[model samples]
Target chain A: MNSLTTAFFIAAAMILFAGCYMLVRSHNMIRLVIAVEVVMKAVTLVLVFAGYSNGNTALSQSFIITIIVAEVVVAVVATGIAIAVYRNNGDLDLRKLNKLNG
Target chain B: MSASLATLVYAFIGLPLIAIVLLNLPNRKFAEKLCIGTGLFVCIVQMATAVIAVLLLIEFNKASMSFSQFWDMHVADDAAYFSVDFLSAVCLFCIGMVGAVSFAAAGSTVRDKILNYTNMMMVLLLGMNGIALVTDLFSVYVFLEISGIASFLLIALYRDPVGLEGAFKYLVMSAIASAFILLGSGLLFLEFGSLRFVVLEEMLQAGVYNNPPLVWLALFFLVAGFAIKSGNMPFHGWLPDAQTGAPSPVSIMLSGIVEQMSGTYATMRLIDIFLLNKFTVVNIGMMLLALLSIVLGAIAAVGQTDFKRTLAYSSISQIGYIVLGISCGTVLGYVGAVLHFFNHSTFKSTLFANAAAVKNQLHSTHYDDLGGLQKQMPIAAATSVIAGLSTAGLPPFAGFWSKLLIIIAVWQTQGAFVASVALLASIFTLAYFLRIQHKVFFGPEKQRPAVKEPKDGIAIASIALSVVTIGFGILFPVLLLALQTQGVL
Candidate 1:
């Protein structure tokens, strides 16, 4: 409703944007996973912000559930793959993974 | 028959959307056959519908009659439209021919996971056709993701380490692009409270917004998101990785259809929506990218020793032609764009199939490891010539018509210089394709152990696709006319 709240929401979105971009830009697998976790939190914040702005508790509750599901499922599965890749190739740096490069 | 044909079309799309229960169905081999049968059956139905639609389209065209429908599932002021218009129906023709030919060729290559293969292929068909037919923004995103996610999974199914890497990158980049799309979509929805493309178009045209910072930002994100899928210069990083690392059959589909459909359709759709105000800037900007791709793709292809990688670069250059055509914003321009899009799918699929066969015959895809396939595989050699010639835009080929129109469109709009650059790029396209074909298939035979003709399925498949190329080239006049009648060209 106010500029302060709008600023908070915008900041939250920027944080998520920055975190995801960092994850993609980072060469380290661990850091990438950590960045992905940040994105999860950011999206949660976004849902909460939107709900709070409109006074929609139902929306926020569903948003929290979606965030939990994302963290538990997608983040976990991707982390496992990242770890496996790290173990197999002996590196966490994406730059080193060019076996797929043509 | 018409009702069943329409029903079949719906099922052709819907069945892939519904998940089928996996059966233990003996070994993977039996599963493969089952998938092949299902995929083939779907393709047959598509072909039947396409033929029937063509017959109907003929009557509609002569009488200038169109059976159109509007569905407004939202509260938008305007509706999302779907019609069996001449443009869409003709696209169905391309989809039917290519879908059938590719399935026929894929027989056992996808034998390992037949059901999954069939599912993905069917979804791909649904997604692609939906993109061609649906005239709504939200529906576009839904179908775009349907195809994009399926494509990533299909590539990942290769299970090789390289394949996994490619799939991962594709998934990562595609997710980011779609997120940008969502962001753009969310803002648009917030402003207008509707996602229907027709409604959005009306609202924008009402002078409510004129190149606002937010709209431009949304457009930028939309372009960037689609560009990743486009596999253009900067965002093209994923392409060689994905295509070269993918399985042979997947390579054929990805190189031939996926990138072309998503990128070209996104651009065309955007141009349509934005045609109200930013026509000049959009045209100039896209023309710049098209030029960049022309030079960059040529340079990249010239440097690649890996066969599939080279084809990947060639694809980039070919996409330049598509972009150049549509961006010119002329009727002839769109004609060239749509026709070339159709032509490329036919020719490039054949090339990839032949590439698969060559890799099979030689056990490697590197240029140094392959030579003189003419004697051993005459059919492949002959088909390769047709494809190569078609890509080079040689006369009497469908490609020539598309490229000629593009060059003319550019020249008429801008200058002789743009046209000259395009013409020079076509020569570059010809040179590289010829260099590879000459060395690999037409040169002196290097006696090697275990040299054999290509496998029956791939050979059969390449021939089928090559026929598509030659047939379309010969029938370019009729096809162009159909596209024009539909106003898509």
Candidate 2:
């Protein structure tokens, strides 16, 4: 692979790992949501790199736009649920959200 | 004829949109009153349209028919559009069937939030129908998100602690799955410059690609994403919690159709297009996952004390059977997988409907809170027995034929050992279901306030589903004979 492709892959992997680390370490619900968004951003980076390399920049741009829109909706819903959880538990900690265990 | 098919295809996506508009045009009270009826109407019409479309496709000897909802988008060679084949037609019918049952249960259970429930249900229907109809991978991701959002909102509708927690967990897991899917699809697009299934299929068949490792990486991500969506064994952490924590009607939707539509349907399509009879390693990997799910899910269900949780675990097990059929990579296996998909919807819906009936009356589904219910709730009890028996693959039920086909397919392709393991897993299925039957329905009577049968929509739905289970079981042989005669077998 070329230098540019190698750089892109390395950057994407770093971002993905950082996002996953945040997801695993964060105990707050809102932070968890942000972590998910971070992971999605990493995916977006990969998609853009894919398009750049494949010479399909227009199609990839459209795909990224749609992904952003959908990702925003998912974030909104996650925040809504987290807020509801906070209301019920008076905190945003993940430990408090374990009521449905078997 | 083509015009008529297009109209039918349009109805699949259009009817739900119109329903949403009509329900919201008036006052809140008016929407509340009209919501259940409108949902039921849309669902029944969808069911009819699916059956009719399948027959028409068969009679005309067409592989599939494509149509756009609004504007024709055939300008480019690989532009995305909607199409319906036999597999999608079957999925559409299953969605309508389970959606109808969900709405029926919602009629009595979700009285206060009826309007909101109806609106979300309509959106969910549109999303699932989109999944069934879309011909491209990116559109599948778009619809998956749509349906996933609807389900998360629906689960948290009451905003109870358990419901919110379940919704949060489901949201996190589903978002991750979507990321995996997007990354995979992007990699595929990088290689092929297209995400349409037909284009990908042709390219893969001609074996045209530069980087084989990148292709394998893409396949890994795609399979993992779909596997997580479908709640297979390793990635099933969110399934039981979500199903148990959602309200009963929503549980019906989640277990019966949503998981299949968002997860298994895409996997089936992926296998059909990309891995058809070629990717033996991928097929074996999928088969192993299926086996793990079937055995582990059933074993886990046996230990669960909650009714909905047990059913959720059972759903994981049944989904395993479907995946196992798909992993066999044979025509008979594909047919078996599809039939099992349909049957799973019917029987699982009936069981959840029974759970709703019990929950509506007793307000709890814990095993300790239930006993000797058969004497009081005969319809729920009797129907649960039939449904449970069907789930265990007993003869004279729809599940039996499908499970039989799947096992035979496994035996033919994988070997006797794998098939026998699948066969023995049903004993665990029977064991846990019998536990449910004894503890919840047929055990010793507990003295408490008078418990009468829930004579609401839930009871009616269970009875209707039971009839379907028995009827389909009896009629399957005739259908098989007809398929044989037509040289389809």
Candidate 3:
């Protein structure tokens, strides 16, 4: 593989790992949402790189745009639920959201 | 004939959009009053359309019929279009049946939120229909998101603490799954320069890709993503929580159709296009996952105290059967898997409807709060028995024939040990369901206020689904004979 492609792959992998780390480490609900967004951004980078490598940048561009739109809606809904959870428990701590269990 | 087929195919996507538009065009009060009727109308039409399309396709001796709604966009060589074949027709029918049941239950359970419920239900139906009809992987992702969003909002509609928690958990896991799926598809697109199923299938069959390792990596991500979406064993933490926390009607929708459409259906399509009759390692991997889910989900369900939670875990187990059938990679296995998918929707919807009935009358579905309900709620009790027996794969119930077919296919292909393991798991299914029957219906009477049967839409929905389950089970042999006569078996 070319040096440019290698660099892109490393960057995407690093971003993915960082996002996953945040997802595992965060104690706050809003931070979890941000972590999900970060992961999605990494996916976006991969899609863009894939398209560029394949000489089909336009299709990948459209795909990325659609992904952005869908992820935004997901973020809105996640934040909305998080806000509702906060109102119920008076905090955004992830540990407090465990009422249902086996 | 083709023209009529096109119209019928279009209805699956068009009717729901029309219903959404008409419902919202009126004023808020008017929409609220008309929402249930509109929802039922859309669902019934969709069910009828699916059956008719399937019949027409058969009569015309065609494998599938493709159609577009607004305008024909065949300008490019590989522009995406929607099509309906036997498999998708079956899925569409399941979506319609389950959507109808959800709407019926919602009339009683979600009276105040009826309008919002109907709106989101239509969107969910639209999304599922898109998933069933779309010809490309990217389109599947789009429809998955649409349905995923609708379900998350449905779970959080009441915004209660538990509902919010369920929705948040579902959203987080689902988002991660989507990232995995998109990355996989991106990797595929990088190699193939197209996302159409037919093109990818052809390319894979020709075996001319430059980057074989990249293809395997893509497959890995896709499998993991879909496994998560389907709530298979290891990735099943959110399923029970979401199902248990959602309101009863929404629970019916989630367990009945949403999870199957967004997850298992995609997996089936992926297998059809990518792994069918090849990739034995992937097939074995999927089979192992299915076995794990089947054994563990049933064992776990045996210990749950709550009504919805037990059924949720049971759903995980039942879905495992469907995946097991798929992983066999034979025509018989595919047929068995599709039939099992249909049976699961019918019986699971009936069970959830019974849960709604109990919750409505007693206001609690905990084992501690339920006892001797059979004497009072005769219909729910009776239907639950039928549905539960069907789930346990007893004779003369719909679930039995499908499970038997799956086990036989596994035996023929994967060997006796795997088949025997699957067969033994049914005993656990029966054990847990009997526990439900004993704890919730036939145990010693609790000294509490006398409860009556829920004289509402939920009761009617459960009865109808129970009838379908019983009818399908009894008629399956005739169907097999007919298929044999046609040289299809």
Candidates' DockQ values?
Answer: 0.29, 0.86, 0.85
Candidate 2 segments whose C-alpha is farther than 4 A from its true place: B73-80
Best by lDDT: 2
Instruction: Give the lDDT of residue B278 in candidate 1.
Output: 56
Ranking by lDDT: 2, 3, 1
Q: What are the per-residue Cα lDDT tens digits for candidate 3 across B1-489?
A: 544555775578888888888998989998898998889888999999989978887898877776654576332334538878889999999999999999999988899998888988888999999999999999999999999999999998899988898888999999999999998998899899999998999899999799999998998899989999999999999999999989999999999998898889999999878956788888998999999999999999999999899999999999999999999998788889999999999999999999998998888889999989999999999999999999999999999999999999999999999999999999999999999999999989998888888678888899999989999999999988877787666
lDDT tens digits by residue: candidate 2, B301-321:
999999999999999999999
Q: Write the per-residue lDDT of candidate 1 for residues B99-181, one digit (tens) a residue.
A: 66666656645556656766677777887777666766655766677677667667766466777678767756665665566
DockQ of 1: 0.29
**Top model by DockQ, which number?**
2
Q: How much does candidate 3 score in TM-score?
A: 0.98
> Considering TM-score, which of the candidate structures 1 and 3 is the better prediction for this target?
3
lDDT of 3 by residue, A38-73 (tens): 999999999899889888999999998999999999
Q: Chain A TM-score per model, please list them.
A: 0.82, 0.95, 0.97
Looking at model 3, the pairs that clash are none
The chain B TM-scores of all candidates, as shown, are: 0.89, 0.98, 0.98
Rank the models by DockQ, top first. 2, 3, 1
Q: Regarding lDDT, does 1 or 3 come out ahead?
A: 3
- lDDT of each candidate versus the true structure: 0.71, 0.92, 0.91
